[model samples]
Target: MSEKFRAYLIVSVGLACLFVTSGVGYYGFAVLNTPVGDEFEWSRGLIMWAFAFFFIVRGLVAPFIGRITDRFGSKKIIICGALTAAFGHFLLSQVQNIWHFVLLYGLVGVGMSGMAIIPVSSVISIWFDEDRGRALGIATTGVGLGGFVLSPVLAGFVIPGFGWRMAYIFLGLVVLALIPLVMIGIKEKPKNYSNDKEDDFKSPDFEKNDVRGVFSNLSFWMIVVAFFLTSMSNTGILQNHVDFLTTTGGFKLQVIGASLGGVGIASTFGKLGFGWLSDKIRAKYCTLLSFIFQAVSIIILLNASTLWMVWIYALLMGLGVGGWAPLSSVLISKNFGLTSYGGIYGIVSSALCIGTGIGPLIGGYMHDLTSSYYQAFLFLLVLYAIAIPAILITTLKN
Candidate 1:
């Protein structure tokens, strides 16, 4: 194979591995929340706070991680992230107190900042331009695939057989195993690689601006704001769907959980399909479609009474939510070149993380205060409507 093709394969594999690790590590909480709450006699809100805390830590650490990737390169940062994630899972496996849960999950959050989409997508952005959106979409599809395949399987089988702690141990070991693959296979774009005797691909022209530069760009701010709102709405659904079904819709916990897995499966295809579509059309339009789809899903979820209704809502929501991941990165790459792409993406991702951190907390809190998630779902619908305008404004020339 040519060096360019080989580079794409290596970077794509690295992104897939990183997504699998971070998805499982970060989302393990969503599946295990009931088990943890039951074991500790904690309120669901309290258990969800752990996930919130994780996002907060991820948001705070993301910019630094991006700066490090920009300055030093992605290799060391990815390896360090993988190992740190392994350690965090190890600590989680042995947790005895709420504080232990907080501390361990905080570390996991930091590790997620290191291991998640920003670094992986940055590397892929460096490797391919013509097919960047599709490449990123394929790489990130790992997260949805992992969740689709692992969440139900782990919750139904592993946790039942070995308990949640042992499940954590197994997850930690699996993530640790990827470290060697990342180290051996992953490489930054070759210093010598070029296109057509012109150095354009070798060192693409872009301003080497910091996070402040990103803040000054109206497009960047619009993307960030829209993403924040979308993330908040998305997280509310993902984190609370099971509870919402069980408490208000009168469904069994297992049924609700499995249906969420169905959402995951739908999301896997959504990510890939929307990503390819972004390459064909404008990414901003794809993003707008995703938000609209998600808003409709949320409305459907609010009124869902039968299992079939829940399943349909899950699939639609999954598609919309899944599409957002790749489309967001593609838009960023189109607006800003690879120069400081990691840092700029990281800042936008920090906004997303912040929204995610607050979503579940507010969702759970609303349930606690109102005795239902109806208010939260309605709130999400409004946010989605707001996001449509935000996204439209992003497409306007500044």
Candidate 2:
């Protein structure tokens, strides 16, 4: 194959991989929460805890996975991740206790950590330069697309027809099926490959240093803090979305599924839009704009009682949340360079994952205590407000 075709092919394969990993591991789990809670007589808080714990595990292992990807490349890491994730999902289908469920989900998290963003971004970084933002944006849309297609499939068909157990099995099988694609399609960076963006790392003294070097830079920390807050806010809303709709708005599963699908669609557009914007304006400014979208969506959500209002909320929130993945990759490359990108991005992702883990737990428990999502959503809004200034500060001249 020609060099240009090979680069695009990597993107295509990466998108497919993310489609299964994020679809089954993230959005699919959200759809299953209601039925899973009902079957086990678990509270929403407990269900949220299970997911929170899973993401925490995913975060904890990300650095190791990134380092591995850097040294060994994507194929091995993806194969291993897909196998582990498939096993976890298969076993998760058999769990009768919450503890077993939580632990197995953690295994799934570990598997997904290997397969998702870090390695994909690392490979994409090595391939494209000038068009990196759009390339990353296009590749990561698999995340939103997965949510769009899988959410309805689970809610409307799989769970209803074959039960939640069969749904997990189906997810496991789909993940396993991705291994062949990776084996055949992915390629390591050529030995002669080089990037001019190395000069872009903000720290001069630490240019040759390891991951510790970036720690001394203020922009790095700002990016971390900003994403942590945004991630926590976005994840809190998404994880509890179905429960919120059912209890607060009294929506049915089919309707809620469609709403979730709407989020996926909006997010897909958000990723592409913000990605293209990253090339035009500063990455931090694009992030600020996305946050504005999210904050307004939350406001709409708080008072939403009608179907149209909820759909509006979903569109705004999805667009806002959608920017995080591609923007995170862009910000990292702009601030830290790509020589050690996998490890550095891994650390940022770890922090982001921590926020993702905590958000749902906090949102769920708040609902348990107050018996309403009003207080919980307000907490998220506060996080968004705090994050805005943090992101803006990252764009200032050193």
Candidate 3:
């Protein structure tokens, strides 16, 4: 097959996989939160913790997943993950206890380990070398699009009418439906494709990657730490996004869904826009711009009183969310090279999981305590500010 055609298929598979995973796993949970909490008589913090654990397990398993993908292939691993995710989501429909929710979400996390950004970016890195950022931007846009299409349906019609259990089953169906795309489209690039020499990750530095000194590098640590902080803000805000609207702004569920829908639409543009810009400029600067967008959104949320304010928050935060994702793979490839890309990227992915894992609990706890997300949002703003310096201070040389 032509590299061009194969590359297109690869990217299409990635988009579908990422889209379903984020929709059902991340944002779908957003829709399910209030309903699930109400049904189980659980506190917001208690329920959000399950999400926190999912991300934590996803991160921790990433290195192993990355290694496993390298040995066998992402195709089988991803398919298995997809199947596991479907089963886990189906079980979520039958959750009768808190322990079941926690355990089943962990199963979903295992599936995420095989499908999330690290694995998706790793595969993309092996295919499109030159427009890596742009390709990833386009592919990662699936995440936003999923939320765009699903949030409204789940929040507006499904959850309100059929209840949250059916929502999980619906998401499981979505995952199963994507399997053909995965099986047909996802395949590793040939090792020595004549057409791919100028593309793919090994083009510039066509040598085996060494991770011996990765831990001792300051810039590597900076990438880790900086993204950790960024993930805290991003993940925390995402977990409680709809709740903030309903609780603080007094918006209805469908109204909150509309705001999230806007976020999804804007995020699509943000991913493409910033991704293209990253190819033209330093990625870190573009990252800084995303940070600014998110910070402003958080501040707006703190004072959000109407639908317009909610939309404003959603748009800015969506841009930040969408833009921030592609840059991670771009930065990691640029800084660490593709030789140990999976391992290095796994560490970074885990850092993101760690940050996200903790953020929701903290955000939920804050809301539970103060009856508002204002203080937590403010703290996220501070973390964004801290990340600016953290990224800028790192010396990429070495």
Q: Highest TM-score, which number? A: 2
* RMSD (CA, angstroms), candidate 3: 2.9
Structural similarity to truth (TM-score) of each candidate: 0.93, 0.96, 0.92
Provide the RMSD of all predictions against the true structure, rounded to 1 decimal: 2.9, 1.7, 2.9
Residue 4 lDDT, candidate 1, scale 0-100: 73
Q: Which predicted model would earn the best lDDT?
A: 2
What shift in Å separates residue 125 of candidate 3 from its native position after superposition? Answer: 1.0
Q: Give the Cα error of residue 90 in candidate 3, in Å.
A: 1.8
Output the TM-score of candidate 3: 0.92
Candidate 1: lDDT of 116? 80
Residue range 40-137, candidate 1, lDDT tens digits: 89886777788888898898888889888987777778878878888898889888878788778889888767878878887777777777778877
In candidate 2 the C-alpha lDDT for residue 95 amounts to 88
Q: In candidate 2, which residue pairs clash? A: none
Task: List the candidate 1 regions with Cα displacement exceeding 4 Å.
Answer: 194-211, 396-398
* Ranking of all predicted structures according to TM-score, beginning with the best and ending with the worst: 2, 1, 3
Once superposed on the true structure, which residue ranges of model 2 sit more than 4 Å away at CA?
200-206, 395-398
lDDT of 3 by residue, 89-159 (tens): 99999998888898899899998778777668878878877788889898999989888888778977888
**Which wins on lDDT, candidate 1 or candidate 3?**
3
Instruction: Give the per-residue lDDT digits (tens) of candidate 2, residues 1-398.
Output: 88888899999998988898889988888888778989889998998888998889988998888888877888899999999999999998898999998899899999999999998888887888788889889998999999878877887799999999999999999999999998888887755787655665444435554577777777778888988888888899888877788888888866777877888999999988988888778888989999999999989988888899989999999999889888989888766777778888898889888889999999999999999888999989998778899888764322
**Reference-based TM-score, model 2:** 0.96
